[model samples]
Target: MRRRDLLASAALPLPAWASAAPERVLRVGTDIAEVGFDPPRVSDRTSVTINAHIFESPLTYDYLARPALLRPQTAAALPEASENFTRWVFTLQPGIFFADDPAFGGKPRELVAADYVYSIKRFFDPRIPTEHLFHFENAGILGLSELRQRALKAKTGLDYDAPVAGLRALDRYRFEIRLARPAPRFVQLFAVPGLTGALAREVVEHYDDELPAHPVGTGPFMLQRWRRGSQVRLVRNPRFREQHFDSLATDLNAEDQALLKRLQGRRLPLVDAVEVNVILEEQPRWLAFHGGEIDVLELPPTLAPAVMPGGRLAPYLAQRGVQARAQVDASVRHTFFNCEDPDIGGLQPERVALRRAIALAYDNTEELRSVFKGQGVPAQSMLVPAVYGFDATLRSAAGSGDMARARALLDTYGYRDVDRDGWREHPDGRSLTLRLAGLSDSRQRAINELWLKKMRLLGLRIVFEPGQFGELIKNSLAGTLQMWSYSWTTSQPDGDFFLALGYGPNAGQANDARLVLPAFDRAYEKQRALPDGPERLAAMRAANRLMLAYQPYLPHFHALRVDLSQPGVEGYRRHPFTRDWWRYTAKE
Candidate 1:
């Protein structure tokens, strides 16, 4: 598990003199952008890279634990429910406005019900591509299933409008929802970033094509311009409410002191302007941040200086004491396999075979120490300890490959040395070897090479292959390649869904290594139907038992994200799938 205790212990209390004074401008550094302005269409971390000032969500996540809620953020008090758990209502805080309204000309918008309805319906919009649709399935939203089927089939048209029986536009401030069954997290689901953000139907309708590059929401900031594939800029939301910071601050917290010093009645956009610059390479960014040209850097493993060079960052780290402000999901990063191999289930054991071979071949320990620099724990299964369906008791003994075991498995499976030669042969006497393909990035290429060396030792002939990241991902999804490393960014804490959910097209789609275990599917179906809590948790455990019995992929480690920022940046946070979560964070 991540050393959460260390982060909590290192936390300092805010000084009593703290106050929310105004400030302006937050300059940011980011990588490349994906596409889409609408939240539902966005899946890549760098794609939604905007500031909190420009965007906001109705349901905010409570840091204590991740579950969505009806409030803008997770609340100390859970929402109250009616007698039958049938009708769900949420009351929003009084005054809020969108960031770029000409009415406020750049004010936040008041939260309301229709906004939620619009957000929910977008999933069913053939035009809108929301990877989070599974989250909306059980809300008892009218015509959801039919709409989803049509949307998935046609990929456009608002056939879902007529099915509004389960959802309502109860006045302006309050929203009501009916659930088919009780989901404790149905309300909290709204708090999550992608799930509950309310969108103005007018804006989405007007600039539908331009939404991705130009974000419009009731957050603290608004998008001014996006220099595609390069950088983005934002201006503060003039009508931002909740000027007070989150109450979790302590007097000694470094952020409190910094906020106090930076916000002293300054104009919004504290500086002349804020820029979220995109840099694909790491060296230039560190040089800029070090030279004081840049204010913050979301340094990844490939970006962080392994040996703090010359003690240059010592004072800055100590004096600033600003740390990564997000929950590190151990499950966020892992390889997806091509579970759909025909023979793997047809002529051969498709998923289970690949999983067994890859797991046994991978040196998770070495990757954890060398690549991650001991910043992360190795994951042996799809679900990490933090996520549901994860079996903590399952210790992987695969990396310790024994030729005896490898030979035994291959011999029984038909890849045996029937011919008296160095190379093994399949039952049909064909060469028994395959190539491992992965990203050509220096770090990944290096790791891939190491795995190749290890796999060769297991009496298997190995070839190291390189391809463009996108192409490799495409091939993995199509099941065209034998073995490749794949990544699913927004993996859930209780994720067995990628394998069980029937979306066969989401690139490097989860369940790529299609195992087709009925018991696993049944357990997952049970899991999917349950609200995201203990009952779902129990069903997921049973499913994990199925995963353990049938290994599906060579599970890898979640990347431990490391970033460097100058002092005075506050409210910068992270999410499960990203190290580059840009928007929703404020700067002094």
Candidate 2:
């Protein structure tokens, strides 16, 4: 059967129970295809959004909390930490069972502490080579790094039976983690979906390397069907444990209170199913939502003016009973220079001067107004609002750009039009050309044109090399791209991950810029050990200043997140850090 026909057939209503409430289903339209379902192997936002519903992390952030408060999800309670903060212990909630799978030999498999230990150890296995290994590597776990090296050297592959001292299971329900040093923010790691979600050994062994296709978890939903790159459907898990909505202690507005009252004490997973369609273009996704084919719409910034003029929903949309909510997202979009490339890399004075001059010449404010249609704010520093250590007083030196100063800096560094071709050449009389790796989308094309126009004013010539997102990521990780544009969204309300992106050890992993700075390394290490206070904030500020001085990334703007939903959709709230928010949502 055709792909669309298959999906349409799957949506046919199921027989309803006489006493049970009617089933509610949510249909979401997205412009990007999910890379995979395996949390450790996939790092893209689309994949994370899809997998989060199927996996249960040890800890999760409150859905409606404004400042992002962490709460226990699968655990009975928050883990207990030692006085020095090096050792922590957690006990799992009893009676939790994994979804039914043939790998279990027809018996329901109960989730245990050993499952979490095995899941974390997978990050260190050289065969899997999970991209998120850096998060664990930086935590100073005693034997993890050594075990990874040992497995790489062994003739045979990793032995899942081997026990590591740093990660141990005390019993079926309890486990402890020992860090080499004090890490005050260690608990935050548990909130990441890739880090704490439990995976059964039997399931992993059955699926082997193709585990992304088979996902077994103890969350509210289970993967029912997936037509790779076309569509995916998730049905409510039959073995999911009972859970109810609880009120928060934090202050909430009137609207939020009303939402809470309606949902309090109600069984979770208000929706019975979720259906996602992959439409890799903004116009089609937007149209799908407008035609009532999808329930929720995440409007792109480029289309903000046409759909929401003056930052408000258009009258036509309002008349259709569509509600709009917009807020500045906790993310920073910028262009990263490959510090390993000889032309744009290094810490010499001339190299720094060139980077700073380029920063000064490019205009972010104009792009925010023209390309983004006033839907974004100029980024002052790497740290966005709401994250700890973000100082409101800190500002970027060339955020708005000083054209005159940029010209002077370039001329002083001997970058001039020597051959009179109206473009600058290398200071040493060598040819100089910068190639930017980009995606061939309308929004990216418009942004690239603006960048080209601004760089031309500095007598510099730049060319765009367009490719797929996956190809760009591969090239960036290999350090083959001279420059590229990317963005990072915070998964927690802390600045450690953002600062760790430039650390030396993360070169081929999270540090796509390949920046190696000893100063940044020391500050980051010190900051991670200290609790949230003035001292840690000071260390984070110092690191931010050093990154600005090095100029590895030309600061860009932080865009706004605009969401639209039909009036019938209730209990909908946007989370700053978490995705897969369908559990608390329902439609009339």
Best by TM-score: 2
The lDDT, on a scale of 0 to 1, for candidate 2 is: 0.82
**Tens digit per residue, CA lDDT, model 2, 1-588:** 454354344332333441287667788777767777778877777788877888877888887777788888888999999959889998899899998887899998998999888888888887774557888889888788888888888855567777777899999999999989898888988887767788898999987766787788988888877777778888888888999987574689888888888888889888888888887778888888889999887887778988999888999999999988888888888888888888878888777888888888888898888877788788877777778887788778665767888889989999888899998887887667788888888888998998888888888889999987767777787789988886788787988877887788998888887889999889888898898899988999888888888888886877688888877888765687887688888888
**TM-score against native, each model:** 0.77, 0.95
Q: What lDDT score goes with residue 268 in model 1?
A: 32
Cα error, residue 195 of model 1, in Å, equals 2.5
**Candidate 2 segments whose C-alpha is farther than 4 A from its true place:** 1-22
Candidate 1 global CA lDDT score: 0.55
The per-model lDDT (C-alpha) reads 0.55, 0.82
Worst 10 residues of 2 by lDDT: 10-19
**Candidate 2 lDDT score at position 88:** 90
Candidate 1, after superposition: displacement of residue 308 in Å? 4.9
* Tens-place lDDT digits, model 1, residues 356-440: 6656656777776666555456665556545545666776555444446655666666665677676566567766565667656
How far is each candidate from the true structure, as Cα RMSD in Å? 8.6, 2.8
Q: Quick one: how many clashes does candidate 1 have? A: 59
